[model samples]
Target: MDRLSNLPNHILSDILSFVPFKEAAKTSTLSKHWHHQWQSTRNLDFNHLYFANRDSNGDVQLQPQIFIDFVQQFIANNNSPIMDKLSLTFSQPGDFQETVEKCITFSVDRKVKHLKLDFSDPTWDENDLDGLAHPMFDLPQSFYNHQVLESVTLFSCKFDVFGFKNFGLLKSISLGWIELKVSTVKALLANCACLESLSVKSCWDMDSLSVCGKDLKLSSLVVEKCHFLDPSFEIEAPNLNYMKYCGTVVLFTVNGTSLEEADLDFGPEFECDESLGDSLYQSLNGICPTRALTVCTYMLQVIPMGEEPTGMEPRLNVTHLTLRTAMHNYEQGGIRFFLNSCPRLETLTIDIDRSRRICNEYRPPFEDKFEDLWRSSAIIFRCITQTLRKVEIKGFKGTPNEVYVMLYLVNHARVMEKLTVITSSEESNNRGPETFRSIAEQVYGFRKGSENLAIEIV
Candidate 1:
């Protein structure tokens, strides 16, 4: 019987596509027929540089000639069909213009379906900028010839204004620290009619134009730290379902048939400005007019903290709620405003970071001057009686003020089933076991009748 381990060449080559090139190369010693089967494999993955030289921190530098020789030899030696995917990394400090061009050429020639490159050198200097000017390494006509190329990932690479004019069938793209002109970005998106998922991060120099396309069928779009994108830019895609935006006030317009979830983390550009919030509110209204929206905002220093919740309407039925407040600014009325606004809120998570000030001291009583302070301190969740179930408190200290907040939750919330207190043991911000024990004891003292309630301290 033929050994299963020694499968036919076609089957063996198919399996080799999943493993790294180096590991597949080791199989050559098994038999004469298996000697060059690795070269014919359809996928080439080069992640062994770090694995091979873990102890050497100086640098795992690979000469341009070494890479050129390997690719040329692999293509020449292969007698079977061309490769389907090519992923490579060259983090060396020296100029690799020739090597980079050759790699791109091989992908075009082999009809690679997926190409990923991590060519960024964090330690690179002005000397390395010379390579960007080389014609061979720049965007070429061959890139547009690879009709089967479905996805591409580029890091710290320069592209022409029309770099994506050829990728008409492209489905997904991820770019990091790459510079592209405003018109180039718009034209590229317009060209990728089938592009579904796009991620752009830390591209500081990108243009400020809004993105829009007609035949675009994107489902997930994530933009982080791409501050150059327009704040009012509207993306018109009916098929998009999930989106996440952070570090910018950019608004997203969802015209899709089904949008299940969306997360927005908007911070003001100016330290004391509320304009970003107003812009975000207006942008969201334009995108999801009739749909229910779950909103959570991180209080940035520049954006004046909202005393009352914004964008509250009975038309948008918000279900899940979370409020993360600065330790010192967490007043009782802030909690009240949230409970009153989100009437349909089902689950609420309140995270309080109290590493700075501890408000356990009590002032002398009998003064009418402390009315506002008392009302603010009494800002707890006694009003939220229905629909609220879970309460989680992070960085909980055993202070009277914090304990009062917990007690208020237990006393008021009718459907609460879980109350968790998570504390750290680090000296600077550690909340000792004594604090936990006190909070747990107080919870049990008040919740003796409620068997469904659970209080865990970790």
Candidate 2:
């Protein structure tokens, strides 16, 4: 007779979807009408950590046997044959291998479309200097051959790739901290003909990385921080529109097909190679005719070595370029080189936000040499006089150098309409509201090339 229980099946299922399965199953005790409603739910999500109640001392206290029994019983009682999504996360899998396998089988049998499995160890330090290791759970071979599967994600697990079969609708795949063979990676990628995006990060146990999607719809690729893999890495996606790489300094061959945007982050620890300049130039050439580019400060070191301005073929046709910098004086030379090479550039953004990037990548505390103007581009380039319209400087802290750049653009950019030097939430608090007024007065007081130019400081 409860008003909540009187709701219709569609409405009840919608409400229950927000809650865990254990809580949803409790509705059966409320009324006869709600008894079997939980059995027909389509989205199945289970987490061992949730059921494994903690003790007074903050340790994981739930019994493994109890979790296994509950999971096995829950799947057996559910009647839905077509699951839209299934996600399972287990804190520890050594003692519960059968439990993990059974849950996967249950979802696979019901034609699950989207699947995600994570086996992060509960006891391990989340931020341990060393990263995650392989988990004990073994995914069933049937998971790879499922015709109805569309997207798959696996984390911190080991699997044999030799059994992978064709997936008709698989469009997206994301793997991290996993172990597999080089041949297996190639075969799996080749099999997913309809795949549109693939991401692999922090994984190990491979000699060479070769991804071939010649006759497929693969368009976006991102691979990052796979330290153990061999130096040799290759990709054959002609239609790739976006790429982001953060690791070693190997030359990536793109088969002459350009990207709309490329974000390259050779990690902070990357040591400069003898061919650093050549590798950097080749990558830009491969993704030439690009509209946008975001490069880390470390990778920009070789730009001033004469590998640019002429070595670049077709030159970069970038309209929007984002340069992540350490705000170091040395990196400014490289930034100037890029501006000269990309003649079509219309908008330039300089970001000094190092909190989100790797450690040691960005030099701390704004430098004091800004009062001297260092060696900035004083010659208002042709792009600034003709095409440059907007300029944004993120993480603005009223540093003298940052203010100088703002004033430079305001005075030189003939066609620039608006210039923004915005501060993040944390930065805004650190720099009180008075800082904005000072910044605005400093730039707006100058006689700009364009009368319509507007300057913003926040």
Per-model TM-score versus the true fold: 0.65, 0.78
Best by TM-score: 2
| Ten residues in sequence with the least summed lDDT for candidate 2 | 357-366
Candidate 1: residue pairs that collide:
238-256, 271-302, 272-302, 332-379
Off by over 4 Å in 2: 1-8, 11-81, 120-136, 160-162, 256-258, 272-278, 305-314, 355-377, 427-446, 454-458
Clashes of 1: 4
Clashing pairs in 2: none
Error of 1 at 91 (Å): 5.1
Clashes of 2: 0
Cα error of candidate 1 at position 442, Å: 7.5
Residue lDDT tens for model 2, 365-435: 22434434432445556677888998888876666566666666777788889888776444454675466
Scanning candidate 1 in windows of ten residues, the lowest lDDT window is 357-366
